[model samples]
Target: MDKKSPSDTAEFNISAYDQAEFNDLLFENMPDYAFVKNDSFKIVKANSAFLSMYPTNIRDKVIGYTTVEDYQPKEAELFLARDKEAFEQGYSETVETITFPDHRIRTLLTRKKRFEAIDGRTYILGIATDVTEREELIEKLRKSNDDLDQFAYMASHDLKAPLTAIAKLVSWIDEDHRSELPVGAIENFELIKSRINRMTQLLNDMLTYSRVNQTPHEKEEFSFKDLVLEQFDMICIDKEFNLSCCELIVSLQKDAIAIVLRNLLANAIKHHHLDHGNIDVTIEEKKGFYLIKVTDDGPGIDPQYSSKIFEMFQTLKPRDQQEGSGIGLAICKKIANHYAGDITLIDQPNGTSFLVTWPSVPTQQPPFKRIK
Candidate 1:
């Protein structure tokens, strides 16, 4: 007190300001709307974010006023009710659409908590995070998916009629005019028929790919071995190729899993160069997913094409050389994604091994440890 140095005085002032304005600094700088209301719901304090909702000249008018005085009556009523609930229950949180003083409607994730100040006064602290853009994006995505589904339905329906008529006409030409045509012409007609057949398969696969997960299906318990056997029975496999699965019970969408297994089995058999090859189907239960490994003793895929294999209409072999729609792997990937899972080609020494990581029951757990 006798002779306080200038630096000591400056330090004292800085410490005092910090102690008094620490909360104010945090509240004013916060990105979200933050405010404090007294027990009677009168706004006692509001941060810059909250004040920004009003005009600059009249921003000070927001303090000491209730939400009813600042916002639309209807919106204010909802806010007051939620505030009252928070006061009674100690806390409340909700995602609500609110109209600001500037008349802008915004979606907000609001949290209200009953708080007590150092003065022993009861208050409510409200913080709201604007989520309008996020919610709007989600809604747009939902609408886009709906539009795509409708387009796919109409396009498939419209295209199939013309495709069927053309197929019938080609068949009639082959049956009724084969003898009258020259040998070269006959081969040409056969080629035309083969092309038509390929077109038909492509259309069918396209339809299947588009319709996947369009409707929700209930999950049910089924034996893994039984599902593999059932799907294998539907497909015509070479006698020398063996398809086997271990015994395990799983709960899943039976029809969806069946479709996945059907595609994988079909792919393995169709791509195999050798007549006698082994197709082994095995399942391993991991931390949070079921690893379905489909190993084949066939000409393995090039590692370069592994990522591209799952893309729609992507194929490693030429369409002319291999009779395939090139949509099987894509459909498998889609189905896996629908269940929050994934399908990938695991590199192997002698042949291709596909790993389907099907999410375990209650598919909300962390991702499974990826196999290297």
Candidate 2:
């Protein structure tokens, strides 16, 4: 047999290089990170996507680096200890939360294999994926579902009493006195019917308000001034209370900021102190947010009763005193929390002002339009 020439050896090595490139292509698009190391645990290679995942360490920061200690010093120490154990025991071992600068952490499951190269060098390979965002989203979704479940249980239980009474009254009227009811009895029956209708409407509205956070919404750019003015126009129809006209500043929503405005405005309209005779709605734009003030010159909300107003079904005044289901402020709180914003009251005597703060979504950039 003829001995292989130098050129033949070069060609054979080139073919092997091509095959390695082909194999890398398969992993190039993979979401998980893949890497290789020598027997000494020095990183020899890392894929393109793997390097991109870690903003702290780009390709130049990592590849061809000696020892995981160069980047992940803590993980290097622990991994070396584990490697020794695995080498002796002859089994793969896992490691977690390999930390670096800026609170960045990655969990890695490393599988080890000892293999001798043609040049007599041994190597080990490892694979890992960033599960941080996935883990957090899962946790948030779980909590959301749990909250919805609680709301369902509460609404069903509370609504039952009014519904049962209304049903019984209807049955009694139909069975006992439908044909021979005395004069004016029909008017009394109509009044009862109206009361039941109102109660049913209130219960349904309360349930809807409680579940607003759980329901998904389409986020869009809307002016806070526009919403406030719209509410003002609607409330203007009620001549009993005068809503003052004030120059409103514009505010934008990048996320669910609309919900914040909706509930706050609704509360302002629903709870205005008619006795105070005037309501002042002010909007101030400052820093990177818009501050909303709904000031009622009416009988001031007692300082003692202010805090509990946001609690579900907690009302300072009886249902007769104020026509409210007691869920509006609770919904305001839920929406504020959902957007990572807050709503609170400012101190004032014989009048109350609710201050709503919302972080502005950057709207300086033009809306997305396809480039021609």
Candidate 3:
């Protein structure tokens, strides 16, 4: 029985790479375009994907040739400069567009690194990943976002003015012909006004949704109780919406947070069994976020409609029975998401509770989904 020593095993392992078949298998099976270039900037070795870039006639002759003639004169100069930089700096990465011999254009993210062989010959190893489709998809997504912003702006400025004018004209008619009108005409006018108000609210909320992440949230310090109280007052002017929360100073985006609180308070009041009810808000500092829980003494939502409640333009009740845009929760969800946060309904037996996670600062990492 023979057992190789540690030094002998290391030497054998290094020498085993001399097996040409193993090297050929690895080089041939690479999914990306890979090649090795000599000091002269001529490709000395290339994989199948690299060879596929050329015509059948030129495939065999591709080795020992530079890409100077393949690209435009200016592009060739820049490519040669980058090649030299990779040799000197040890690495270079770039996104390049290439028109193959078959006239198919492709965008690639290319990484080039310098290496030296055991025999002391210097070479540049390059690996290129095709990003043509990914780049196209990203561009389309950017265009789609821009179009939504434009539509929101149109809805706010252009569409809203005409809608307000129509509401005013209806009011003027009601005032001028109140005595001459029929019995149920007054109720019809009120219904018309309510529908108009709902549409206006929808437009405003849509604008808020589009602009939620449009600008960065600026951090500011304020009393949490004060902010919640202000929005509650705005939502429930004459009606009493009782709220109970411990006062604490908070540092976060004030305007966005106010919008979320307003929607939540309005939701509680609008869906409550009585005209006024108790609302409890608890705000505490977690590891990296401000945890906000808004609980109301109202009839809770069904577990089946939990996911559907956050959808845009979704309503649990008919429009005639309850006058609302139904975009409030969706907007609150959007604002929370924009800051690496989340808003979820805490399904309970008695009352409705909404748990909102808000990061103190702007972040890309999502907050933990731990909620009661």
RMSD, one per candidate, in order: 7.0, 18.4, 7.0
Expressed as tens digits, the lDDT of each residue in 1-372 for candidate 3 is: 878788987765644557677787778889899999998999999999988888787787789888668666766686678789889988777777777665688888778889999889899888888999998998999999889878887767688899999999999999999889887998899889988998898888777777777887688999999998888878887667778987889999988899899889889998998887889998999888999999999988998899899998899999889877778899899889878799999989989999999987557543222111
TM-score of model 3 (CA atoms): 0.77
Worst 10 residues of 1 by lDDT: 363-372
Instruction: Give me candidate 2's TM-score against the actual structure.
Output: 0.53
TM-score against native, each model: 0.85, 0.53, 0.77
**Backbone atom clashes (below 3 Å) for every candidate:** 0, 1, 0
Q: Give candidate 1 misplaced runs (Cα > 4 Å).
A: 1-20, 38-40, 56-61, 84-91, 114-123, 361-372
Stretches of model 2 off by over 4 angstroms after superposition = 1-179, 182-195, 215-223, 245-251, 254-276, 362-372
Residue pairs in candidate 3 whose N, alpha carbon or C atoms collide under 3 angstroms: none
Candidate 3 local distance difference test against the native = 0.85
> Tens digit of lDDT per residue, candidate 2, span 6-25?
99988656577788887888
Residue pairs with colliding backbones in model 2 are 276-298
**Of models 2 and 3, which has the larger TM-score?**
3
Ranking by TM-score: 1, 3, 2
Per-residue lDDT of 248-296 in model 1, one digit per residue for the tens? 9987778988889999988888888976677889998888789998888
